[model samples]
Target: MRVTAVRTTRAPAWQWAGCAALVLLGAVIPVLRFLVFWPMDQWQVDVEVYRQAGVSILIGRPIYDAMTEAPQLLPFTYPPFAALLAIPLALLPFGLVGWLWTALQIAATTAIVWYAGYRLIHRGGSAQPLVLGLLAAPMFWLHPVGDGIRFGQVNAFIVLAALMDLRRPRPRVLSGVAPGVLVGLAMAIKLTPGVFVVHYVINRRWREAGTAIATAAIAWLAAFVAIPSASLAFWGGALQDPARLGPNMGTSNQSIRGVLMRVGPSGGAGVALWLVLIALVGWFGFRLARRAWLRGDTVTEVAAVGLLACLLSPVAWIHHFHWIVVAILAILGADPLRDRRRLVAALVITVWFVCRLPWWGISWIAHDWPPILVGRILQNADLAGALLALWLLAWASAREPRDAEADAVARAGERSAAPGKVERRAASEAG
Candidate 1:
C-alpha cells in the first residue's frame, strides 16, 4: 500500500490567493445564494431534521415520532446511532450548527479531492494549490454538491470516509481505530453506505468487511443500550419503509426502481423488469469494479462502487449524487495533457452536472411540450450520468493494458514522466 510521495515546492503568495478566489467563486457564493439567502432556499433544513432528532434524544421523545415543521414534516430517517451522534448539534444553537455544518461539508469535499485526485493535482508542483483551486471551484458548485451543502447533508463526509478507507497507504485518522471503522460509522448514520460492504465482499477483503460489519453492530449495540425502544423501532421497522424517505416515483429519485416507477409500467411486469434491471446493472458494475481492483486501480474501484450505490439505492435524492465529484477524479486518470480522451469525457460530465437539467426537463413536462421524450431523458440525466460513469470507469481502467505490448508502452511513458512504480501501477489510483 505504499505510495511514492511527490516532493512539493513552497507555494507563492499569488498561488494561495488564486486558490482562495476559485473557492470563493465556486463554493462560498453559491452557498450564500442557494442555501442562506434565496427566497426559496431550503436553508439547511436537513440539518434541522438532524438537530430535532437530537432534541428527541435529549427530551426523551421518540426519535422517529418527532418530525420537522410543517410543509416538510421530515422525520428522523437515519439510524439510532445517528440520533445519538446528533446530540452535539442539539447542544449548540441551530444557527451556529448550520454554518459549522456547511463549513464541514466544504472541508470534506476538499479532503475528497486530496484523496481522489492527489496525483493529478500534485503534478503541478508549486502550483499545486492553484490547480486544486481550479478543480475545487467547479467541484463545489456541481448541482449535486451544491444541493448537499444547501440542505446541510452528510454525503460529503461519507464520500471522504469511503475514499480514505480504500485509498492506498490509507490516510491518517485516530490511532488504532482500524481502517473500515469509518465505513461502518457512515453506515450507522445512513444505510446507503451498505454498498461498500458489497465492494469489500467482491474484492475478498474479508478483514475490512468484517471489521465494518462489527463496527456497525457495535454502534447499534451502543444505541440499543442507551435507548432500547428507539433502537428497536429503527432496526425492526424504520429502515424497511422506503416510503418514509419520500415519493419514490418522484423526479428526485433517480435509481433504477425510481425510474421504473415513473415509467408507469404494469404491476407484475414492472416488478420483474425492475428486479431484472437491478441484477444486470449490479452484476456488471461489480464485475468491472473487481477487475479494476485486480488491475490495481483502487480509485476507480471505489468510484465505480460509489456510482453503483447511487444508481441502485431505492431513494437517491438530488443531494446524494455528490459521488459525482469523486467519479470525476477517477475518470481523469493520469495527466489530462497526455489523456485527451479522458479529459473531454470528464469535462462533458462536469458541464452536464453543473446545469439543473433534470428540473428543466420537469418544467418542459409541466408546459406540455411536444418533445416529451427529450424532456424525460433530460429529467433522468443524473441517473444516466451514473451509468455512463460506470462504463467510462471500465474503459478508462479495467480494459486498459489490453496486451503486454500496450502495457509496457504505457509503463515506459509513465517512467519517462515520473520515477515510481506507483505511478505505473494504477489507472485511477492514489499517489
Candidate 2:
C-alpha cells in the first residue's frame, strides 16, 4: 500500500491584507484623536521642549538655556545629540510638527510590536502577519504606549532601538561592532539605554561593549565640538542633578528608587535601601540573562536586560515602562502549556498594567487612605511587576532544557526502544 502526504494550505493574501489594515487602523485612530481633539496646552509638551532645543541649536542660542513657555519652563533633559536629532521638528510650524511627531510615534510603537512578535512568536511561516496584528492590537492599549504617544515621549523609539540591537544578526565585516553602534546611538539620545552596555559586559561581548563606549564617546565628542559650552554645562553640572529630571517620588516615577523614596526611608536610609534593591535586582537579572544567552533564548535575554534598565534607573517614568512589552512577550513566549501558573501570573500582571491600576488605585484612595498604605501600594506596582517578571524569567530559564542534554535524552530513549522494535519485527516475520 502507498500513502499520500498531505500539504497544508497557507493563509490567503487577503487575510494578511486584512491584518495589515487592522493594525494600521488600530495605530492611527488614537493618534488622530490626540492630535485633533486634545487641548493645545496638553499637546505633547515634551516635543515642544525638544523642538525648542533644536531651534536653539540652529539659531546659536544655548540649548539648555532655552525653556518651554511659561508655567512649566521645562528645559531639555536629553543628551546634546538628541537636540541635534530634533532639528527637523524645530524647523516646522508647531501644528505641523505635532501632527508629524504623533505619526512618527505611532509608527515607532507599531515597529516595536512587530519586532516583539517577530522575536517572540513568529516562526518563519505564513502566520507572521496574523501574529503581528494580534500583538499590535493589545499593545496599543498598553498604558506605556498610550502615555508615550500622549507625551510625545521617546520611549517607543528607545525600545525599538534596543530591540533592533538585540535582534540584529552578527555582521560579516565588523561582526560585533554593529550591535554596539545601535546601542551607542540609542544611548546618545538618552542615557538610560546605556544600561544595555552593561548587558554586553555581562555576556562577555567585550568588542561590542568597547565599541558601544567608543561610539558614545565619538557622538558626545561631535556634540561637544558643535556646542562646547552647552556640552560642558550639561555634562559637568546638569547631568549630576537628579532633581533636574523631575520629582522622583511622583507616581509617574516607577523605578525601585521611586518606591523607596515614597515608603522605605529618607536621606541615607533611603539611599541604602535603594542600593540594596539595585544590587539584588542586578545580580538576579544579569544571571538570568546570562543563562538565557547560554540556552540561546533571545526573548528572555531581551526581557531581562530591559527590566534591569527600568528598575535600576533613578527615574523610570510610566512611559519608560514600555520595556514591559518585552517582559510580556517573554512570558508569552515561554512554554505556556508546561508553565500554566507563570502564564496566568503574567496575564494578571499585564492586565494590571493595561488598566493602569497603580495610578488609578492611588487616585481613588488619595482622599480616603493612609499615606503609608497608599504610597506602598501605588509606588511599588510596576516595580513589583518587574520583580515578579524577573523571578519568573529566572525560573523558566533554569528549567529550560539544554540542547546537549535534550539530545542525549532523545538518543537514550531511541536506544531503549530499539529492542522492542526488533522483537516485534521478528514476530511479524515468523508469523
Candidate 3:
C-alpha cells in the first residue's frame, strides 16, 4: 500500500516578507526618533539620578545622598536593589546609556501592548499582529508613556514585570513560583508593585504570594549585604520622608493624597481625608477585582489592581499612569464591538489620555482660572480618569448578563485560546 504525503500550508512569500518589514520599521522608526531627534535636555534626567546612585554605590557614598551636581538635585528614591540594578548604567557613558535606555523602554512598551492585546483582548491569528501594531504606535504618544521615556523612568519595566507575572503561561513544575519571583523582583526595585501581593492574596494564590514576599526579602537581604549603610538609610529614614520624593501637592503627584493636599484640608485633617479616600478606593477596587475574577475576566482584575496602586501611592507621578494602558485594553476587551456605550466610553477615555488633557488642564489652572471646581477637576484629570475607568469597569462587570451574552463571552475566550477560523482559512488558502 502507498502512503500519502502530508501537506502543510503557509502564508504567501510576499505576505511573510511584508509582515517582517512592517515589524522592522515599527521597531526602528520609534528608536531613531526618540534617541536622535529628541533634545538632549530631555534625555532622561531620572536616569541620571539612577546612574548617580550606582556611582555612589561604587564610590562608597550613600545612595540616598542628593545628586547635587545634577540640575534636579534628585535623590535616589527607589529601593536599594534598584541602585544595584543601575550599576551597569553607571559604568556606561551617559550618552550611550540614554540611547540604550530609550530603546529598552520602547521595547518594553511594545511588549506591554502586545501582551495586553493578546492576553486581554484575545486577538489571535493574523489579527494579533494588526492589533499590536495599532496599539504600539499610539502607545508611544500617550502622555504617561512619553513621560516615562523622557525621564528614563522604570515604570515601563515595572508594568512589563507585572504583566509577565499576571499573564505567564502555567508551567508543569512550580507553576506559581515564576510569577511570584517576578513580582517580588519588581517590588524590590520599587515598592508600589507590592500591591500585587494583595492581588495574589485576593485570588487565593497562596504559593505565589508567599514566593513573592520571600523573594523580596531575599533581595533586601542581598542589598543589605552589598550596601549596608545605604540599605539602613533607605529603610530607616528616607523611605518615610514623602517630602524627599517630590512636591505632593504638585500637578505631577496624581494620587488621592495629591488631590486632597491641593484642595482639601491641611495637616492632620488632610491626612485623615486621604486615608478615608484610600480605604474607600482600595475597598471598591479590590471588590471589583474579585468580581471580575468570578466572571472569568483577568484583564479587569489587573486593571483594577493597577489603578489602586497608582491612586494609593504617595507619589504616583504622571509617568506612573502607564497603568492606563491596562484600563484601555480592558475596556476594549469588555465587548466593545458589541456594546455601543462601552465603545463610546472607551473612546472618550482614550482621547482624554492621548491628548494629555489632564496635564494641559493643570497648565490652564496655573493661569489663575476663576472656576476653581472645573479647574480642580481638570487638574486632577489623571485621578479622575482612573476613577471613571474603574467605575465603568465595575458597573459593566456588575450588570447581570443575559445567558446568551455570557455564553458568547465564554465562547470568545475559548476561541481565543484555540486556533481561530482565520488561521484555518489561511491554511486552506495555502493548500
User: Which has the greatest TM-score?
Assistant: 1
- lDDT of each prediction vs. the true structure? 0.79, 0.72, 0.72
Q: Tell me which residue pairs clash in candidate 2.
A: none
Q: After superposition, how far is residue 389 of candidate 1 from its true place, in Å?
A: 1.3
**lDDT per residue as tens, model 1, 1-431:** 32343322566999988987877777877687766685543568899999999999899999988888876789889999999999999999988998899888887887788678766766676786787888888898788898888888999998888887876534545335786888898888888888989888877889889989999999989999999999999878988898888888899898888888887486999889988888899998899878777765667878888888888877888888888888888788757667689888888888888887889899988998987998898888888888887888877784344222222223332233344333233433322
Task: Assess candidate 1 and give its lDDT.
Answer: 0.79
Worst 10 residues of 1 by lDDT: 402-411
- How accurate locally is residue 205 in candidate 3, as Cα lDDT from 0 to 100? 78
Q: 1-431 in candidate 2: lDDT tens per residue?
A: 12222222255797688777767777665676566677878788888888999899889998876888876678888889888889998889987887777778777776766555443333323565676676676676677777787878888888877776775222123344466787888899999888889988877889878878888889999999988888998998889988877888887888999878877889998898899989988998888887776665555677888888889999988888888777776666524556686577668767867777567657756656666576457546877777887887777666655323222222222232332232111111110
Per-residue accuracy of model 3 over 1-431 as CA lDDT, tens digit each? 12222122223555445544554455564455556676666567888888998898888887897573534677888899899999988899988888788878877877777565554333233344444555566666667877787778899898877766774222123344565788899999999999989978977879879989999999999999989888999999999999887888898888998888888999898888889999999999998887775655655677888888899888888899888887777676634566667667767777777677666777778887777667778888888888998998786566543223322222343343333322211111110
Candidate 2: count of backbone clashes, pairs at least 3 residues apart or interchain: 0
**Number of backbone collisions per candidate, in order?**
0, 0, 0
TM-score of 3: 0.84
